[model samples]
Target: MKHLDINQIKEIIPHRHPFLLVDFIEDYEPGEYAVGYKCVTYREDFFRGHFPQEPVMPGVLTVEALAQVGAVAILSMEENQGKTAYFGAINNCKFKGKIVPGDKVRLETRIIKRKGPMGVGRAEASVDGKIVVSAELTFMVGQAGKND
Candidate 1:
């Protein structure tokens, strides 16, 4: 198992602030599973509009965060690096709780299956051990080497 700091994660995924939701990857097992964190802050751009007085991380962003972590997990596999994984579909997605400012949300992803360029996985978001969201995500991995 390995941990990925923000800088290392930046290398694997093309996401940045306001969009780069994962702050730190806590644990990762190549070709298996990965866990990451997102610390919510009042300064987040969406909070300004989502609700000025009472800010809460939107459900969509929560899902995106999970997806980003999943992407890192899949790409970290030796066979997938330097490849772009495009989200193909999200299935059985459910938002169970609210994520507010000051919350540290943990995202966990597990590879369910991988066949050729397509892969399927399950992801969940939690805060203080409480699940907030979960989904089954499918994506296509396009290797840069292929067209280069």
Candidate 2:
């Protein structure tokens, strides 16, 4: 298992700051799969209003985190360097448990298929080895800085 710090991850994917959900990537094979983690904290801006009482991690954001992992796997490819993978579709998603502060969420995304500029990835987020979210994500690679 290889490891990539946030700096290395940033070189592969464009996401940054609060939007860069994956804190560290443990292992990833370009155009194949990515394994990463996010350390949830109460100090997060989302917790301030996502719920003052419950503070559950937003489901959509969890999926976005997975997509970011997929982006790393796809963008890390030598030929695809500096490209941006945009969400084309999200299918068959499921949420089984709540994610709150103090949880270290495990994120995994595997590219199941790819044809030209489009591809599909199987993504999931788990905590304590229990899957809390899963989805089949579709994406389209576009040139960096493209408006579309």
Candidate 3:
């Protein structure tokens, strides 16, 4: 079991501020798989308008958290360092339960296959051992030159 703090995760992926969702990664294997967590809280900006009384973490954001975890795994690789993984497609995504503040959403992603810059990952989000969302995500890794 490996671990990555916020700073270490930032070294791999370029997301920042409110949009960056993953809090910590506990299990990571470069280019293979990773498991991370997001600590949902009432202070989140989206909770303000998503619903005033009953706030729920949006399902799409949950998927994005999973994608960020996937990026951590893929970008941590030596060859893929300083790169960005963009979403190519999302398939078979299903949300089974509601996720609200005070819940910790555990995100896990594993690369199933890859060809050059394109790859597929099996991703899921769970809370208290209950599956909340599952999806097969397609991604394309990109690297920018100093000028670009």
Candidate 4:
């Protein structure tokens, strides 16, 4: 089992605080798959405006979190080192449930196909074993530039 802490995850992906969604990667296989977690808290900036009265994690952000998990799987490959994976497209995306603060989202993304610098990942986000979101994400790998 390959476990990755936040720092290790940062080494593989370029996301940062407030945007870096995955809190801990439970395990991963380079170019294969990654399972991670995101501990949602009330202090999150988005909750402030997303719904002060009744906070809810935005669906888009959840998808991004799932994407980040996929990024870890893709970017961890030796050939992809120091590279960035950008979303080429998001297909079959479905929001099945809402994510709330205090929920620990379990994220998983499996690389289903790859060709050259492009690939597709089957992603899912769950809380307490209940699927909240699922999508097929297409990615395009490219050189990581400072502007990325």
Ranking by TM-score: 2, 4, 3, 1
Relative to the unseen true structure, what is the C-alpha lDDT of residue 118 in candidate 3, on a scale of 0 to 100?
89
| Candidate 2: pairs in clash | none
**Candidate 2 per-residue lDDT over residues 1-148, each given as its tens digit:** 8789999999988889889999999999999999999999998889998999889999999999999999999999998998899999999999999899999999999999999989999999999999999999999999988865
lDDT of 1 by residue, 32-140 (tens): 7789999998889999899888898899999889988988988887878778777889999999999999999999989899888788889999999999999998988
Clash numbers, per candidate: 0, 0, 0, 0
Alpha-carbon local distance difference test for all models: 0.88, 0.95, 0.93, 0.96
lDDT of 4 by residue, 1-148 (tens): 9999999999999999989999999999999999999999999999999899999999999999999999999999999999999999999999999999999999999999999999999999999999999999999999877443
Report the Cα lDDT for residue 34, model 4.
99
Work out the TM-score per prediction: 0.93, 0.97, 0.96, 0.97
Give the per-residue lDDT of model 3 (tens digit) for 29-148: 998999999999999999998888999999999999999999999999899898889999999999999999899999999999989988999999999999999999999998754322
lDDT of 3 at 93: 97
- Lowest-sum lDDT 10-residue window in model 1: 139-148
lDDT minimum window of 10 residues, candidate 4: 139-148
Worst 10 residues of 2 by lDDT: 139-148
Off by over 4 Å in 2: none
Better of 2 and 3 by TM-score: 2
Q: Candidate 1 has which clashing residue pairs, if any? A: none
Better of 1 and 4 by lDDT: 4
Better of 1 and 4 by TM-score: 4
Question: Regarding lDDT, does 3 or 4 come out ahead?
Answer: 4
Where model 1 places Cα greater than 4 Å from the true spot, the runs are: 143-148
